[model samples]
Structure formats: C-alpha cells, structure tokens
Target: MSSKYSLPLVLSFTIHIVLAGILLLGDFSSPPKPTPTSVQMEPIQAVIVEKSKVEAQINKIKKQKADDAKKLKDLEQSIAAAKAKRLNEAKRVKELERQRKKKAREKKAADIASKKAKAKANAADKIRKQKEREKKQADEAAAADAKAKRIKEENDAKKAAKKAEDLRKKKAAELKRKEQEARERAAQQKLLEQQMAEDMANRQQARRQQMMTEIGRFTALITQTIKRNLITDRSTMEGKSCKLTISLAPSGFVTNVVTGQGNRIVCEAAKTAVYKAGTLPVSKDPEIFREMRTISLTVAPDKFN
Candidate 1:
C-alpha cells in the first residue's frame, strides 16, 4: 500500500511469472532407442536417467521460489518499522507547538495587567493634587473677606464718635444762650416793681388830705344846726358851754344823747333841743359817713343870742 514497498512488490511479481514459465515449459525426451547387447536393460536404464534429471531441476525451482518469498516478507517488515518511526516524530512536533502557544498567551496577559495598574495610579495622583489646590484657594478667599469686614467696622465706629461729639457741643451752646436771657428778664422785672411802689404811696397821701378837709366841713355844719335850735337864757348861760355825745342812724336820725362835763342848765336845754330836731344832715358816701355815726360836740347857747 505504501510507495516505499513498490519496487519490492514489482520484483516479487516478476519472479513468480518466471517461475510459472519454467514450470509450464518442462524438459521433453524422445522415445527410448532399442540396444542389441541387452535390450531390456539399456532402455530401462536410459528412462530412469531422464526422470532423475527432471526431478532434480524441479527441486531447484521450488527452492528458488521459497527463497524469493522469504526475501519479500523481510522487506515488508522493514517498511512497517519505518512507518512507525515517522508517526512517533509527528506526535513529538505537535506537543512542542502546544507548549509554545500556551507560554505566549501567558506573557500577553501579564503585559496587559501591568499597563492597567500604571494608568490607575496616575489617575489617583492627579485627583489628589487638584483637591489640594482647591482647598488653598478657599482659605485665601476667606482671609480676604475677614480683612475687608474689619476695615469697614473701624470706619463706621469713627464716624459715630465724631457725630456724637458734634451733638454735645450744640446742646451746650443752646443752654448758655437760655441762661443769659433769664438774667436780663430778672433785672427788668425788679426795676418795674420799684416804680409801681412809689406811685401807690403818693396816691395814698393825697387821698388822706382830701378826707380830713371833708370831715372838718361836716362838723361845723352840725354845730350850727344845734345852736339854731337852743333855748338860751343869756344872763346865766353866758360864757358857759355844754359838752354832749350823740348816736345817730344811717339816715342821720338822733338815737340817744349823753351829757358830759359842762354847764348843767345848758346841757339839759341842749339835750331837749336835740330830741326836738329828730333828723340831721349826713354825707351820702359810705367812707365819709363812718366818721359822723357817733359824734361829741360842745354847744354854747350864749353865742347864738
């Protein structure tokens, strides 16, 4: 079946064809010749010699066939051995290829893992740096705001203090002006009071002088009335006067008469005359009449005669 056994198989087939041709063309012999000396013995002897030579040639051909078959069997065994060796070599090559592929895959996987780890580490470092920068910026902004607020508060406090001082000075000036006005008003009031007191005293002295003159005029009129009504005896009443006290009503009606130290005769006569004259002259003004309600007089009848 294999090409390596082609020549051996062709050679074996040719030797088989040659052996069949030799068996088919076996030795041919002529009929036995008759001999005169011993007729039976010579012919029999010749036939036996021919048969033995043919048998010997047949034995030689069988031996050659056996040898060729033995050689063919040995060739087939050699070819089987060579086929087995080639199969074993192919199996060894396949196993080596599988080992190489597995090692290559393992190396590729390791390289990919290393790259991924490096990328992750770089990303984490970048994020941390960014956070630190943001924190620093926030702290700076807060400090700036605090400084501005402090400055504004200081300015406001100064303005408030200055305004308060201005208000205090204005109030003090107003108080001083009011005090000066009060002192001027007090001096004017004192001068006016002194002038009013002098005018009142001068008016009172003039009123007293006028009231004294009116009182003297009324007293002389009353004495003249009494003397006109007296009963006089000139010899005994000459140079003798009578003193009398009289009480009168609001309309000048004589109520009662009392005699005081004087001439008894003239006093009796005067008392009778006053009773006869029931009414007398009186002032209509209330202040003038208060002085004449009770009056004392000395009447002398000799003067009337």
Candidate 2:
C-alpha cells in the first residue's frame, strides 16, 4: 500500500524468482559435479534464511510507518491551531462593531437633551422682555397723568388770583367815591354860613358911619380943653398926625386903645385927654355900638400942620 512497503516487497519477489530459475537451469549439476561425492543441501536451512531476510525487511517497514504516523499527527495539530486563530479573529470583529453602535447611541441622546435646554432658555428670555415692555408702558402712563394734574392745578391758581385782584380793585373804587361825596357836602355847608354872615355885616356898616361923625365932634371939644389946660416951653407942637382905634362897652367907657398911624407921644397925649373925659361920646344904638367899637383920629398942635 505505502511506497516504503511496496518497494521492499518487489525487491524480495524478484530475488526469489532469480534464485529459482538458476536452480532450475542447471546450477545444481555444477555443484553436484564438484561434489560427486553426494553433499546434502537442507530445505529447512533455505527456509530459515528467507525467513530472516523477510523479518529484517518487515522491521525496517515498521520503523518507516512509525515515522510517517508522527509526521501526520504534526500536520493535523497545525491545521487545528490555524482554525482556532480564525475563530478568535471573528469574535474580535463582532466586539468592535458592538462598541461603535453603543457610542453612536450615546452621542444622539446628548444632542437631543442639549436642544431642549436651549429652547427652554429662549422661552424664559422672551417672557422677561414682555414683562419689561409692560412695566415701561405703565410708568409712561403714570407720568403723563401726573403732568396733566400739575398743569390743571396751575391753571386753577391763575384764575383764583385774577378773581381776587378784580374784587380788590372794585372795593378801592367804592371807598374813593364815598370820600368825595363827604367832602362835597362839607364845602356846601361852609359856603351857606359865609353868605349869611356877609348879609348881616352890610346892615351894621350903614349905622356905624353916622355914629362916627358924632364921636368926632366930642373928641374935638375934649382936645380943645386939654390944649387950654397945658403950658409948654416949646412954641410949636410940631408932630405927625395920629390915628387911633378904641374898643368900648355899650356904656361908652374905653376898654383898650390902639394907635393906627401916629407918633407915640401924640397918641399918649390923646389917650390921656380921652381918659380925663372919662367916657367917649359914641353911638346910642346898640347895633351901632357892636359895629363901631374901634375908631381912628389925627392930632397936631396947629390944625394945618
């Protein structure tokens, strides 16, 4: 079957065929001739030699078979090792695929969460802006109301001031009119009194003129008597003419004497002569006495002078 056993079997069969042919061809005669003496070749001894050679060949074939068996076992071991290595590579590829899928799932979830958070923040900011806008509008409205109230108050104050000023002016004008009317009444009363007094004075003046002529004659008589009574060293009584006024009671007695236009010496002499007479010759009428209490006269030593 194997090349090692088949090669050894072919060589042994060919050697036996040749040894038999030589025996059959006359090889025994040649040996017998050399042994004309009868030499006995043992059949048992040939069988023993053939058996020994076959045993030796069998031993060699067994050794070769053992060596071949060992080589076959080694080749089987190498094939099993290569199959195990391929199985390990396939498992490693599967694990790497699983890891990649897991990582992709985690990244997708994170992106979704981030989008939601951003949206929530945007909504909060929008609400804040709306509230601010409302507050600003309310403040503006309040400010406008306050400003209007202030303007109204100022207008009312101006109207009140104008009303007060007008009332004051009207009161002042009324007081002035009353004062003017009072002064006019007083002036009219005074004018009426002055007119009545002037009428009474005119009647009294007519009687006083007649009584003054009579008193002048009596004064002349008294002067003549004093001139006769007196004696002087001087020859001429040269002096200025004197006029005098006299105030008297109704009884014609002198109350006081006043010189009008004369020297002091002549007036004193005239006054003394009137005193010696003791009473002036005046008007008998009471009305004439009231109007003629004062009189004026002139005196000189010589009549012409």
Report the number of the highest-TM-score candidate: 1
| Per-candidate TM-score against the hidden true structure | 0.41, 0.30
Number of the predicted model whose lDDT against the real structure is largest:
1
lDDT of 2: 0.66
Q: Model 1 compared with the native: what TM-score?
A: 0.41
lDDT of 1 by residue, 94-165 (tens): 888998898899889878987997889888889888988998898899889989989998999999999899
The number of clashing residue pairs in each candidate reads 0, 0
Cα error, candidate 2, residue 13 (Å): 99
Q: What is the C-alpha lDDT of each candidate?
A: 0.78, 0.66
After best superposition, candidate 2 residue 286: deviation in angstroms? Answer: 11
**lDDT for position 162 in model 2:** 93
Model 1 scores what on Cα lDDT? Answer: 0.78
Give the lDDT of residue 223 in candidate 1.
76
Residue 251 CA error for candidate 2 (Å)?
8.2
Estimate, for each residue in 194-246, the C-alpha lDDT of model 2 and write its tens digit: 88778767756654556665556655653565455333223434644556676
